[model samples]
Target: MNDSGAVLPWLVIRQDDNGNRYRVGRYATRAEAQKMADSLDARGHKQLYWVERIGQSVQ
Candidate 1:
C-alpha cells in the first residue's frame, strides 16, 4: 500500500499518437517505463503516455 493505504503504481501510461490513448499500471516509478521502452519486446516504437497517479487506483 502507498502512503494513503492504496495499492497503486508509481506511474501511468499514455500513447503519443493521434488517438492520445492512456493506460495505467502498478509500476514502481516512471523510470520503469523508460526501462520497458529501452528493452521493449515489440517490433514497433515504444510510445507511451506517463502520468502520476491521483485519487484511488484504477484497474
Candidate 2:
C-alpha cells in the first residue's frame, strides 16, 4: 500500500503508436511498477511504457 493507504497504487501503463492506452498492471510500490514498465520498454517495441500513481484510494 502507498502512503495514501491505497492498495496497489502504482500502475504500469502501455501506449501504442496509435495513441491507445492500456493498463499493464498494478503494484504496491512505485519501484515495482517502474520495473515492469522498464522491462517492457527494453523489448524495443513500438509501444511506450510508463508508470503512474492512482490519485484516490478506495475505502
In the range 1-59, model 2's lDDT, one tens digit per residue, is: 65788689788888889988888998989999988999999998989888888884322
lDDT of each: 0.55, 0.85
Best by TM-score: 2
Give Cα distance to truth, residue 24, candidate 2, Å.
0.3
For candidate 1, the clash count comes to: 2
Q: What would the TM-scores of all predictions be?
A: 0.37, 0.80
- Range of the 10 consecutive residues with the lowest summed lDDT in candidate 2: 50-59
lDDT of 2 at 54: 82
lDDT of 1 by residue, 1-59 (tens): 86778655555555665756566455665577555544542446656444555454434
lDDT of 1 at 47: 69
Off by over 4 Å in 2: 1-6, 56-59
Candidate 2 residue-wise lDDT at 20: 82
Q: Among these predicted structures, which one has the highest lDDT?
A: 2
Clashes of 2: 0
Candidate 1 wrong stretches, greater than 4 Å: 1-6, 28-34, 37-46, 55-59
